[model samples]
Target chain A: MGFSISVEGGQGEATIKLVGELDAAAAPQFKEAIEKLAVDKPQRLILHMDQLEFMASAGLRVLIFARQKMGADVSLYVIGSRGPVLNTLKMSGFHHSVYLQDTYAPE
Target chain B: MDKLTLPAVLASLAELRRYAREAAAAAGIEEERSYQLQLAVDEIATNIISYGYKDAGPMAQIVIGGEITADVLIITLEDHAPAFDPRTRQMPDDDELSKPLEERTIGGLGIYLAMEGVDRFDYRREGERNLNIFEMRRRNG
Candidate 1:
């Protein structure tokens, strides 16, 4: 329906699972989550986006926000983003800002 | 072609997307292509609604309509805001995109992504209305 963000993992790693549509209306919740997560200073911030149904430019802006908030050293990963969500990332060239993978195995 | 009149606001985006989905499906557009169509429309609508006018008052109304023919898909957005042309924007140059995150600009990517998969995108001014036309060749073509 809307958007939900859940943070998992611990120590230097955290997985933020995003579900539902990520449009302009839903972006605030996402940004709030990112703001909260940034305080943890996780070395690896994994965005698990397999269930992310749609992503508009607003959502893309949040991805940029996360990069700037987390700084240059935090290695960010976008996992399993498909359909419009993936296409939006690729089309806007935001795909370059994160490591995209079919799956992420926590070590 | 089915039509929807959306208030220019972020709150209207979900319903705008719903209308886009129904229009695309009724036109026999498949899921993938429909997504592209929706993305293209969303980007434009967001721009017109978010920036075209500065008012919490009666927002500008954006009318969107679409038709898919045997060989092509055409989407039209009619807005009564100040005349602006989206096609005049060039795709973000390599240098802009290549800029480091902290150095990159905040805006401009939305309109750039709007034209990504479409075959031809045109903009025109008719009296007080700005008509944006988005066309794409069907995959089978």
Candidate 2:
């Protein structure tokens, strides 16, 4: 229904934990977070999505935006997405752009 | 189980979700099938609002309706916008989805997903309106 984002520092990476639904209304917030992260230019961007319940097409656009904003040199990790949320990412072909993991690991 | 209507836009996505759940349940679709139906409907309705009427100004109207008969779920979406047939759009190559952001073209991906998600797809241009009909059936039957 909504999204909450948190940024954490770990070794050489930045981990973002997202919870709740990511749709059109939530995309702006997600975009802002991505923009803020782009400034730091972390070597790795790990997204923890275990608590994220859903993702709309607009949400997918933000993921694509993050990929572009962060540049290819930065690794992107998506962790713990399940059910419809995971299927959506796969169907939209976003799974190919990032590393999908069952859990996040400290870098 | 019931019928509902709402404006056709991203904000109405929740309404579509509710309709999908009701229609799928009435059609005897299981959880997985219902989820697929929801995804397909979302793709189609989203396109009608975002692209079909993109330049038509703000007065454009879209109506979504659905009914379930036995094992089939039927959805009809009609919009008053420039004549456009979603079925005519070519499906984007899956290989192209990962292309660099600048090289990627906008649009068509949602239509592709909707087409693949449904068991049946049909489109008709009536007067100044576009009508899209979609049907979903359980994989086993």
Q: Among these predicted structures, which one has the highest TM-score?
A: 1
DockQ of each: 0.60, 0.44
Taking the true A–B contacts (Cα pairs closer than 8 Å), what share appears in each candidate? Answer: 0.53, 0.26
Model 2 lDDT at residue B24: 75
- Give fnat (model 2): 0.26
- Candidate 2 residue B130 Cα shift, in angstroms, is 1.8
Report how far residue B93 has shifted in candidate 1, in Å. 1.6
lDDT of 2 by residue, B4-41 (tens): 55655667776776677677776777887677777677
Residue range A1-107, candidate 1, lDDT tens digits:
77787877565987889998887778898888888888888888899999999888788788778889988888888999987688777766666767888899653
**TM-scores of the first chain across all predictions?**
0.90, 0.90
